[model samples]
Target chain A: MIILEDVHYTYDGIYTALQGISLQVDDGERLAVIGANGAGKTTMIKHMNGLLRPQEGRVILDGQDTKFMSVAEIAREVGLVFQNPDHQLFLDSVKKEVEFGLRNIGFTENEAEQRRQKTLASLGLEGLAERSPFTLSGGERKRVALASVLSTEPRFLALDEPTIGQDAHQKNRLAQMLAEMNKRGRTVVVVTHDIEFVIENFPRTVAMAEGQIIADGSTNMVLSNDEVIERCSLAPPQMTLAARAIRNVFPEVGQRLTLLSELEETIMGILGGA
Target chain B: MALIEFADFSFKYLGADSLALKRIKLIIDEGEYVVLTGPSGCGKTTFCRAINALVPQFHRGYVAGNVYTDGKNTRENEVATFASVAGLVFQNPENQLVTLDVEKEIAFGPENLGVAPAEIRRRVEELIELLDLEELREKHPHEMSGGEQQRVAIAATLALKPKVLVADEPTSNLDPKSAETILEIFAHLNKRGMAVVLVEHRLDLVARDASRIILMNKGRIVADGNPREILAMDLCEEIGVGVPKATQVYKRLRTRGVDLRNVPLTGVELAELVQEATSQ
Candidate 1:
């Protein structure tokens, strides 16, 4: 659905954030981009949604070069949710905030309202529909920002740290929402430092370091690589660590288990028979 | 001494209908490490603000009860007076930062208090080594990474030498390793006899370090106990707080009538427990 061919990006004509980056994201593929701060994760996502054009090389979305497409035109296909909610939220009320993006995309007032309600309801923000967004908490504001993008119904969705202030239940809800979106054949890309969230949800993973892609493979393959995780300043999720420790005692147990349910099942297979 | 005390306190924000905090009675002692957690808008932030007098003073809310910090009445003391008693590290490090360079930012707090240059130097040097921010000391605050900026914010807060540190979701924006480092720093500070009140939603990373866990919901304290006690209850999952992954596995095993020896909180502990059980 999206392809970045040897793309390079720089800020202020001096600081380079992406260097010779190349990757192909297939249609309806759920991928996670993981990295430390300044690893070009955010810069890379901006390229996907036409927020920033690469200084060198091409960012092609749906077989069209992004440089040739207007941001509004590209936004119809790719919706980008920034890391900070405050940067994106400007409207006073929650209902209006979600409606703004849909309205911008030339949706009728009736259609925009329908999407606004459905998107807010999907993220559990229906109760706060009338409240001022500024009065909401950090987590609530994050949901509103996400709703604004989801209301646009873009074919390719890119989220930067979508689970920043969310609690466990809220995180689970978001994961489920993303899964539903993926099921509907929309391409999803998440840029995050949230290793656990990625391990549990995203199937494909790419790790970046110092403005370049260092590792790209299955989520388990990339996250279990201690060297890559160390280079990215990320800690493996507790489930992976626990699975490794179990593997030490019982070598039959695998080392790549990333979810608690998977680890539990493995432990039961080994111990429950006893 | 009790570092902070709230007695039947309730507050309504200016122009708001409902009270943000309601009938909260709590006490945090000197040198205690407490983790306050809840779903968003559950009044955890309001409680943190109450500790440093940001509740009624700066926030301008209607108060119904007393809040005392460092044995001083919150209403009687100025927010500036709480500086040496309680220091706040907000969620966003960029929002809290003021000075240009890391060194100057760390020194900004102490300098404002008229601390001697030699004393400021000593404090700044101590925090730099404590946070391992020596490499970032000369870098501009705006130029550093999110982790580095948060570390600088911590160093700046430590420069105040407050008896209590109230950090509101300090690691929410950081990566796992950086988040662990922040918690380790808090644990170290707690050992030095500083009362630490951390408000965080990511309990899996910070739970073990806290001696006490105070769970709030809807402007009220719903649960208060040690880490093990709190995680053992079903309330953790009910309240949307994440119990440790190890704990979840243990809980699942116990539910299946497995005779687990201990409720392990970490991966190593869970592995060892499983090994012991299987061997038996």
Candidate 2:
């Protein structure tokens, strides 16, 4: 769905945000880009959506270089959700915000409204149709931002920090929502710094630092190793550390569990016949 | 005397019908680490600004009752007086930053107050080393990353040597490692006899570090207690606030009828508790 080959992006022709980046994400794949602040995660997402073009290399969406595509054309192929939802949401009403993009693409009023209803209902935002988008809370802003994107029905959805400022329940809901989106055969890429979210949700993890890709592979391998996770400025999950801290007590239990669910299962197994 | 005291204080922002905070009475002991949190619009940030007299002084609204900071009444004390008493690091580092360069930014607060040049030099040097920002000292704000900028913002505020450090959502935008560094910095400051008031949602991160936890809602403090006691309450999870991983494990075990007394708040604590549980 997305490919980056020696992609180099420099903002204003002087400052390089991404340096010679090479990454490929297949359809229906859930890939997480994990890094600290200014690690080029946002830069990478902007390239994927063709918002920023590489000065040196190429960013290809389905084998087509973004250098030739229009913003409207790229918007159809890839939906980008910004970190701050308020910055993207401009319209007064929630329904109107979702339909804004569709209307821009020259959809009929009836078609746009139909698309809005479907997208909101799918994201469980149906009842909030008439409410003012500005009056919504932070989490609601996040969902509405996503609703606006989902209304366009793009093939690949790239979200930058979908779970920021969210509560525990909202975090889980976002996790489940992303999982469901991936299961529905939509390519999903998330840029996040939360280690727990990366460990539990992403099947494949890509680590970046100082405008470069450092590590990319199965989520378990990328996040389990202390050196890699630490170098990327992420700590091991709490359960992984807890399991490691008390490994001596349970000789049979491994300290390799990354998720809480894995630790719970291991604990139950150690307790015998759960 | 309490560094900050609020007795039945309530406030309504300009153009708002309902009170943002209601009947709020909180006394923060000097040098205490208080973790204030609740839902997104729960008025935790409003309460933090009350210490710096931002609520009634700068922000338009109706403020009721009494608020005292460092023996000075909030209503009467000029915001400038609280300026040295309290330093605020807002959530967005980008939005809070005023200067272009890191060193200049760090020196901004003291400059605003017209502190002596020699003291400013000492403070700038102290905070540079304190926040490990020596490498980025001369870098432009736009040149640095978000985490680095956040550190600069805090370092700038810390240079003022405020008696109270009120950080609003300090780590919400940072990565885990950066967030850890931030919390560690807060802990170090709190240890230096500075009252650190952290308004955040991630109670789990500072579960052990906080001297007390005060959960706010609808402009009112709904729950106030020690970390262990307040986190054990079910209200925390329902409202989207988090407890430590250890507390979460204990809550799960308790739901399954397992009597896990005194669950620790960190991974190390959980390890000891598990050992004790297995041995018995």
Return the top candidate by TM-score: 1
TM-score of B-chain for each predicted structure, in order: 0.96, 0.96
Q: Model 2: clashing residue pairs?
A: B21-B219
In the range B207-263, model 2's lDDT, one tens digit per residue, is: 889999998766778899998889889998887786777677767777766655585
Candidate 2: residue B11 lDDT (0-100): 87
RMSD of 1: 1.6
What tens digits encode model 1's per-residue C-alpha lDDT throughout B1-280? 6779998999888766577899999888988899999887788888988998998899886899999998899899888999877999988999999989888998999899899999999998889999999899678887888788999998899899999899999988887777888889899989988889999887778878899999887788999999888887898889798788898898898888875797788888899998899888
RMSD (CA, Å), each prediction:
1.6, 3.0
Query: Which CAPRI quality tier does the interface of model 2 achieve?
Result: acceptable
Q: Report i-RMS for every model.
A: 1.4, 3.0
Superposition TM-score, candidate 2 onto the true structure: 0.90
TM-score of candidate 1 against the unseen true structure: 0.96
Candidate 1: TM-score of chain A is: 0.95
